[model samples]
Target chain A: MIEIKGLVVRYKTVEFKFDDYKFKKNMISIISGRNGTGKTTLLKSLSSLIEYEGNIKVNGEITYNSQEPILFNRSTYENIVYPLRIRNLDLNLYKEKIDKYTRVLSIDHLLNENALKLSSGEKMKVSIIRSIIFNPDIVLLDEPTTHLDLESIVELTTLIKELKNELTFIIVSHNSSFVEELKDEEYRLGGNHVYS
Target chain B: MIIESTMKAVELLFSFDSEIYTIIFLSLAISLLATATASFFGTILGILISISDFKLKRFTKKIVFTFMGIPPVVMGLVVLLLITGPFDGMNLLFTKSAMYIAQTLLVLPIIVGNIIISSEKTQKKILETATTLGANKYHKITLLIKEIKPFILMSVILGFSRALSEVGAVMLVGGNIKNDTRVMTTYIALNNSMGEYSMSIAMGIILLLIAFVLHTLLARFRGDFYD
Candidate 1:
């Protein structure tokens, strides 16, 4: 479970004060706003990548996947297994999961290719797989669908929906269809969140 | 006259002369050693400078970047003073060790400066990514180094290039002693001064070839990684 109280992010002179929100575990929530509204800033703040004034109560470890993910100068396999490798986790434990997810995302062929050469959409897919493979507690994805095509986006939406039972997600995206399809709740940065 | 000398230079290149080969081999060994040593320390220092936040950061960077342009003669003088002064009884002047010391100093700044600049550009993003992925301090540093290895290799190559062309420092500290400390650059200078144009040209050609081969190797390394 993750709860935010009086979350405020200030960059230079512009300030963003997000409404208080409580996001439950084993669910997908969406944070949406227009440009300059600090949507990504909120995600970064949650990840502790930037400084902010707020209380973010999270139950477990977290992973933040950037909108434009940084792929190392290595193969996609290396990039995908990075989060696990760094945690000193047994990569063999996740081999089956990696294969399953790569097939779902249709990036199985790209696993051995140089990651830097992948198309933008392919890179985003790689980033998504890398992020979720380690099965962190809270995953914050900032505009992850920006480079993804419609079919890829649908595939991702399904993947997130399927994984939401095990991993909590706070996604910042403007893809209305994706948000409508995957979100169990929605939080507007400058406004309030609606929980059905 | 120039063409005649070039012809003679070509002839001498394949002559299998022991002296020429000896000087070539000595230069390659010493420069490789100096570059390797400088790279090891320079890259560590560079990574430290990039990751550390201190009050004197700006000032320290200014000084280091300034040293990147330090003249070989100036470095030679500094090493000369160090050896001839406080360590007078060391009898270190005009030896291969002195030349090695001088060349290391000459190449250190180049390696450090290049690494510092490249690391500064990539460290923040790489570290941020690693942190988000739950890496500890040791893991973050290791990942950063692994990711920026190409840039580190480039710094090493730059250091080697600087060491390969070095003449002033080696000439001063090495005394260009034949069969002892004579290297390609110093050997060329010595031969050129003695009207041995063919020998100088032969060394020059070999020097250029080494540079080309190293650059091609770097290109291949970078290409393999960058798609």
Candidate 2:
């Protein structure tokens, strides 16, 4: 569970004041807002990526997946296991998880290739796998479906559904279909305020 | 006349002069040592500048960039004054250590500036990624350092090149003493002033060769930094 109050993010002349609310655990919450609204900023603030004034109480570890997702200048296999490597987890133990994820995403053949060379959609898939392979408690995804294709989107939705029981997901996306299919509830940002 | 100098220079090279070899070795040693020290500090400072924000950050960056353009002669004079002024009691003037100090100053700005420029675009993005991956302080630094390794290596090479080719400051602080503080650049300057064109040309050839070898060796370690 994540709770926030009096959350404010200021950039130059712009400001985003969020409502006090509790984001439930073990659920998919989609933050939806118009272009100028602070949907991404709110998500980033939750991930602690942005400086905010309010208090945030989180129940477990969180991982953020950026919209475009910058991969390290390394092979796809290496990029997938980065979080694990950082946590000092043994690579051999996660071999099956890696294989399963790559196979499900149809990226098994490109594992040895440089991740930066992959197409945008493939890169997005790689980023998705990397963010969740280590099993963090909460995953914050910013516009995750932007570069994904229809088929990839379905695969990702299924992947998230399978993992929904184990973790909470806070996502910001303009893709209505993807959000409609996966979102348990929508938190709409009305310009600088919360409407939901 | 050029062809005559070239031929004589070639012959002098095969003559295996110990004096010439000593100058070459000393030149390499001084530049390598200076580059190493300057790069160590420059990289740390570069990372700090890229990652941290303070009131004086813009001013500090301006100072670093300004120092990058300091002329070799001016640097040499400043180093000379430093040793002979407040540090006079230490008696470090006209020593190899003095030359090292001068060369380190000469290259420090270049290394820092290059790193600051090269890592500027990627630093924030990479740091953000590391943060999301649950990196601790040590992990973040190590990840950032790894990402910037190629640029750091490039800075080191550039610093070494500047140090190796500089004559004014090294001569000023080293005193260009024969068999003691003499380096290739100073030796070339001294020997050229004495009208010994053959050895000067030989020294130039050796200097060019050293640069070529250094580039070839270090270029292999740059990884995919170009991409």
Candidate 3:
């Protein structure tokens, strides 16, 4: 479960005001807004990427994947293993889970290839797989399906649905259909809300 | 006359004279060492400057940016005076160590400035993601460093090229001592004074070749970076 109360963000000439909100455990919440409406900024602020004034009470760990996928020069396998390594989990313990996710994402073949050489769709898949490998309490994804093809997008939506039982998913996207397919609740920002 | 001089320069290079090789080797070694040290430290400082919110951060960046345009001769003169006057007891003036110090100072600003630009460009997103993930300060820094590895490598190469080709500051500090402080640029100067035009031209060609090799390596690395 997560609770965000009175979040305020100010970035050079722009201000974002987020009111108190609560997210239920193991539920998918989608935030929909047009471009320049502070959707990405709000998502990042929720992820703790931006400095904001708020009280975010998260019961467990949170994992965040950015809108633009970030990949190192290493192979896909190594990229997926980064967070696991940071958490100090034994690699052998998660080998089966990693293998399953890679195969499900159709990235098993690209595991040995340098991640920087992958296409945008492939990189996004890898980034998503990396974010969820360790089963964090909450997972924040910003436009994860933007670069994906129709088939890949469907597959990802299915995967998110399957994993929703174990993790809270907060997604920020402009694709309303995709959000409708996954989220039980939705919120739209940037229409007459300001903080005094 | 030009053709004859060029031919003689080629001959001197092929001959591999001990004095000429010594100068070439020393220049490459010292410049590479200085660049390596400066780039390592400068990248860390640049990342710190990019991420941290502090008073004087803007002023510090402005000072470093201004230092990037310092003339090599003026930088040389400053180091020379400092070593010979205020800290004269150390007697670093006209020494290889003094040359290293000057070259380090000359290239540090470039390294720091390049890294600052690169770090600022990418650090915001990485920091945001890491923070949202509840990553501590150490994790944030490590992840950021990984993200900017390619730019950091570029900065190091730039610093290396700048230090390797420098002549004025090194000449002022090293004093072009035979068999000791003589580096490629200073040796070229010495050979010219002795009317060994062939030797000077040979060293110049070698310097050009080294520069070419350095750039080629950097280009290859950049290709890998983008891939």
Candidate 4:
């Protein structure tokens, strides 16, 4: 579970104050707003990627995958397996999970291809798979649907729904259809204040 | 005269004339070691400064840029004073070690400055992304080093070029002593001053050859990483 109190994020001349809220474990929560409405800012603050004033209490591990998706200059398989390798986890233990995710995303064949050569949508898929492969307690995804096509978006939405039972998700997206499909708690932000 | 010198330069290169070979080897050994040492430590300092945010950040960059433009003659003089000061009794002056120290000091800023610029270009996104992914400081630094390796390679090569082609600093610090401290650049200057045009021109050709080889290697390395 994640709890927030008096969350205030300040940038140059603007400020955003989020209402106190609690996000239950093993659920999908969507934060939606128009462009430049601080949707990404709020998500970043929650993930502790940006500086914020307030208290955020998170129960377990959390990881964030940005919208732009940073990919290493290596093969896709290497990029996906990087976090595990760095953390010294046994690759054999995650082989089944890797197979399932890659097969679902239809990226198993492209695993050996150079990640830098991948198109934006394909790179986004690779990044998403890489981020969640470790199975953190909470995942913050910012604009995950930006480069994804209709088909990939549907596939990702399905995957998120299935995984929500095992971990928590805090997503920032402008896609109404994607939001409608998940149908979890929603927080709408406007200027300096947020509404639930 | 030009044709004769060119032929002599070719013969000296092919036959590996002992005197010329010794000079080339000394020059290469000193310059390569200086470049390697400077690149190892200087680039680490540069990468650390670039990734960090602190109050003195702008001031530190300004200082590095200023040092990058430092005159070689002035650097040589500074080094000469240091060696001839408390360490005067050590007899480091007119020695290859003195030249190595001078050249290292002269090229360190070049290596560090280029690293700072390249790290600014490449490490920002990677650093931020790594932070978001819950990477610790060590992991982030390692990832950053791996990512900007090509730029680092370019910087080290540039430093070597500077060290190899340097004349003013090495001459002042090394005194261009015969056989023991003579390097390619100093040898060329000495021969030219003595009106030994053929030998000077030969050394010039050898220097050009060295530069060409370095550039070709850098190009091949870039291809492997970039492609």
Candidate 5:
């Protein structure tokens, strides 16, 4: 569960004030707004990536996947396993679990390929998988489906739905159909106000 | 006289003249060692300044950037006073050690300035991503170092060139002692003053070659950065 109160984020001369709300645990919440609506800024503030005037109470560890997924100049496998390595988790023990995810996502064939050379959609898939592999308590996805193909989008939402029973997902997307299929709650932002 | 000196310089270079080689060896050895020492500490200083946010952050950066343009002669005079007055019993005055210290001072700012710029450009992006992935401060620093390594290498080459071509500071403390603290630059100065045009011109060629190699290495590192 995550709770926010009196949240104000400012960039240069513009400021955004977010509604005070509590996000339920183990649910997918969609945050939808038109272009240039500070959707990404809100997500980043939640992740503690930017400065904000607010109080946030989070249940557990948080992970943020940016709109454009970042891939290193290494193999796809390494990119997926980076978070685990950072946490000093044993790779061999989790090999089977990682393999299962890769197989399900149809990324097993790309395991040894250079992640930096992969197409945008492929890189986004790898990035999304990497973000959740370590089981963050709250996962923030900003425009996640922007570069993903239809099939990859389906797989992503399916994976999120299956995992939502144990994880809290805060997603920002312009894809209405995808949101309609997966969102448990809608948080709409526009005209300097938040509508829940 | 210029054509005669050129012929003599070519002949001396091919024959590996002992006096010239000794001077060359000392100059290269001192400059390389000084650059290495400066690089070690300067890298830490630069990274700290880049990643940290403090009240004096802007002022500290300003100081470092200003130091990058410090006159070598000014540095030499300060060091000379320190060695002869405060460090009297150390007997460091008029020695290669003094020359090394002076050169290190000259190059440290170059390394630090370059690193600060490189770190500022790269640290934010890498830190944002690393922190989201649960990386600690040490891990983020390592990542920062890896991404800015090409810039560091370029700074080192730049420092080396500056140290190699340095004459004022080394001359002040080294005293240009023959076959002892004498380096290529001081030696060139000495021969030129004594009308030993051939020897001075030969040393000039060696200095130019050193500069050329440093520039080439810098270009190569720049290419690596872009790639």
Candidate 6:
């Protein structure tokens, strides 16, 4: 579980304000907002990537995936293994899991290819898989479906559903359908909340 | 006349003039050393400046940017006076060491400025992701550097090329001493003055070739994570 209070982000002359909120464990929370409305910034603040004036009380580790996938020049497999290596997790223990996820995402074939050469959708899948492999208590994804096609998006949504029981997911998306499919509760920014 | 000189320059290179070869070798060795030293320190400083939030960051950045425009001759003169006066005990004045110092000063600002710009552009997203993941300071820095390695290399190579082709500052400090501090540019100048135009042209050709080869090699050496 995670609780956020008085989260205010100041950038130059503009400021983004977030009301107090609580994110329940094992539930999906989707934040929907327009462009330049601080959706990405709020996500980044939660990730500790940006400075914010707020109080965040959390009990478990957090993993963040950015809006644009950050890829290394190595193979897809190496990219997926990076977080594990950083956390010093046993590679052998996660090998099967990695293979399984890759197969599920249909990226197993691209495992040995240079990650930079992958298509945008493929890269996003790899980034998602890499973040999931870390097994954080909460995974914050900033527009995870941006570059994915319809087919891949469905597959990814399914993957998220499968992992929903094991990890909490907080996703920032502009797509109402995508949010509707995953969100247990939704936060609509820019005005008072009106559920559709 | 230019075409004739260029043709003669090619002939001189083919003939393998010993003096030209020595100058070419010295220029490569000294500039490479200077580039390596400056780039290492510059990149570190750039990253620190980019990541840290401080009141004086803007001021410091402005100063570094200003330093980038410092004329080589003026810089050489400043270095010359410093070495000959307050730093006289070091006896680096009019020596190869003085040349190295001048070249490094000229290139350091450029390298740092470029790297800082590149690092600052990408650091926010990267830092946020890393920090949220419970990554330590060391891990965050390592990841940042790995991500920016390509831009850093570009900055370093730019600095190297700048330092290698420089003449005024090195000449003022190195004194163009024969068989000693004389680099390619200085040697070419000396040869031209002595009516050895062919030898000077040959040195020029060699310098151009070296630059081309270095650029090609750097382009071919893929970055750690360039996607």
Q: Residue A188 lDDT in model 4?
A: 74
lDDT tens digits, residue span A74-162, model 1 = 89999999988877889999999999899888999989998888999999999888888988989999899999999999889878888
Best by lDDT: 5
Clash pairs, candidate 2, are none
Better of 2 and 3 by TM-score: 2
Q: Which candidate model has the greater DockQ, 1 or 5?
A: 1
Q: Which residue segments of model 2 deviate by more than 4 Å?
A: A193-196, B214-223
lDDT of 3 at B75: 91
- Output the lDDT of residue B14, model 6: 76
Q: Which stretches of candidate 3 lie over 4 Å from their true place?
A: A11-14, A33-37, A188-190, A194-196, B193-195
**Residue-level lDDT tens digits of model 6 in B157-206:** 88998898888899999999988999988888888899877777778888
What is the C-alpha DockQ of each candidate?
0.76, 0.76, 0.50, 0.65, 0.61, 0.47
**Poorest lDDT segment (10 consecutive residues) of candidate 5 chain A:** A187-196
TM-score, chain A only, candidate 1, equals 0.93
Q: Write the per-residue lDDT of candidate 5 for residues A1-196, one digit (tens) a residue.
A: 8898998888656688888888888889999888767899889999999899989888899999999888765789988998899889999987987887787677889999988678899888898889888999999999999998888889888888888887899999999889999999988877774333
Model 6 residue runs over 4 Å out of place are A6-19, A32-41, A174-177, A187-196, B1-8, B218-227
Q: In candidate 1, which residue pairs clash?
A: none
DockQ winner, 1 or 4 = 1
Question: How many pairs collide in each candidate, listed in order?
Answer: 0, 0, 2, 0, 0, 2
Query: lDDT of all the models against the reference?
Result: 0.87, 0.89, 0.85, 0.87, 0.89, 0.84
Superposition error at B89 for model 6 (Å): 1.6
Q: What lDDT, from 0 to 1, does candidate 5 have?
A: 0.89
Chain B TM-score, candidates in order: 0.96, 0.95, 0.94, 0.94, 0.97, 0.92
Candidate 5 deviates by what RMSD? 2.9
- The alpha-carbon deviation from the true structure for residue A146 of candidate 2, after best TM-score superposition, in angstroms, is 1.8
Best by DockQ: 2
| Model 4 C-alpha lDDT per residue in residues B79-117, reported as the tens digit of each score | 999999988998999998999999999889998899899
In candidate 3 the C-alpha lDDT for residue A90 amounts to: 99
Worst 10 residues of 3 chain A by lDDT: A187-196
> Model 2: number of clashes?
0
Q: On a 0 to 100 scale, what is the lDDT of residue B89 in model 2?
A: 89
